[model samples]
Target: MPSGAVRMSRKRAPEPASQLGDVPERKRVSWGILISQGSWADRSPLHEAASQGRLLALRTLLAQVTPVTKGCHANIATIDHVTPLHEACLSGHVACVRALISAGANVNAATFDGITPLYNCCSSGSVGCLELLLQNGAHTRARHAHLPSALHEACKRGNSQCVESLLAHGADPDLKVPQLGSPLYVSCLHRHADCSKILLHTGANVNVGRGNDSPLHAAVRQDSRDQVTLLLDYGANVNSRDEDGRRPLELAPPGGPSQQLLVSFQGSPRTLCQLCRLRIRNVIGRSRLKHLPRLPLPPLLTQYLEHM
Candidate 1:
């Protein structure tokens, strides 16, 4: 249109969407483009970064997700009632947890089985995650399909720290579930000797037995010497009978400290176990002693003789 110089040709516009050739086979990305693309590297980077404690990489990848999709993550299923938040909390993924919470994930979401993320963390000995979930308003009283509560899981796992944290956050140790008795019963029944001690110190029921028997009955059935000792120390009724009329002593071997069962019942079968043991001990001791050469009594033997 002018004489001074040749006019430059106009650039052609981009082809219309319908004119593209099968979308040019869209390059398979190694990482997600908005969502994860068809690239294993894309999916693996997050896990690898997390495993390596690469906080910066994790943050970068997480930040790429658009705000619209932020709260769309779910690691669990409708059938199982679990979520990614639950897994992260249970596995002690502190950074992932923080990211999930910050992304508006539901902290109190329960699994199909009624287990919350907080319960998993407590059961798996993740005190930090437990605290995190509680701080974010995770319910401590949430129960699993078969579990009682976070308190029950903590006690069952023998995690005293988790138990303390749950209690401090207002968990009910005595909260009774339908099948399991109390959190204390869960502790004693699962052979958590130290947990039982803590529960007892906190006024948990000493004789509160669940299932078919009292806690004493459960202790004796396990034949856990430490549990038996603890229960007795806590003033468990040694003579307390279950539905089958069995005492704690009935479950013990003949020589256990509680073998006598220590209570009398009118018109009931008398427990002569102590007399029977004394007779057996005396016969065995005398037979063994008769074979030994006469010697001066040692200090320990003198003490025993004096006690006898």
Candidate 2:
């Protein structure tokens, strides 16, 4: 044990709530024992097992411990309030996560720094862990101003599967952070074409980004042809100005790939099919796009809506 080890108490009373709106308040306060004087924080054997992906060890520990410390969401934590579920998700340990969830772990339980299992899983790029959390009704929200939303993390990490799962589970693609912009913009900033594509398919606003900068502008600055092409296909405004009052094309090099691509689209008309697709998508609305198949549409048209 480190010198000056001390037991820590809960920072605030737990709020018995679910779902993350504008800004999340640590919905459930968790308990932890830690060294108040050192960098090392107290962790249970269950936390160790989950973080190491030792499913069998975790299950045995779960059976041996009292119900309070048996891997429940609020049972154990580090000084920062990291639960076993948080540990498992951080390491992308699917089996450990499943076991913890089975034992009634809180998927949405946030740490002192506002880290949640969903955010951890996204950071680890684990689709399995992400899916499990969503199925358990974990709201993809963040509580700290310092951390980005789960969707933003997924986009920044370029985890298309996580992005898709988050969207399907009702993550706001347009949810903006003070410094990180929207999920779509994060995807573009990171040059994650697949993630950007997924956001557009889910009906994220093509024009939204950090304050005045657009996703197209971010893509241009990064010189990512794939991201730029995806944004253009998704109907990003070419004339959209950033806070610096420059169009995306202006940010590109004198004759770089982005500039060339922008020039090609200038004075050109989008295909009739593309125009029709955008029109239908706008009418259907973001919240209703997932239910497009259930609408009275042809199979071919539905496929177009999904892929095109």
Tell me the spans in candidate 2 whose CA falls farther than 4 Å from its real position. 1-38, 67-74, 143-147
Point out where model 1 deviates above 4 Å: 1-58, 68-70, 74-79, 143-148, 257-308
Please provide, for model 2 over 1-308, each residue's C-alpha lDDT reduced to its tens digit, 9 standing for 90 to 100.
Answer: 55533222223232233422321221111122231234433777888798778988888887876766655533577777878888788678999988888887888887775768888787778899999989998987676555658888789778899999888877888888888898999999998999998999889999999989999999999999998888888778999999989998889977789999999987587788888888888987898888878978899989898765
Q: Which lDDT value does model 1 have at 4? A: 32
Candidates' lDDT values, in order? 0.59, 0.78
TM value for model 2:
0.82
Q: Residues 159-268, candidate 1, lDDT per residue (tens digit)?
A: 88898787777776567776777777787778888877666544455777664466777776666777776666555666678778887667766665434333222234
lDDT of 2 at 89: 80
Number of the predicted model whose lDDT against the real structure is largest: 2
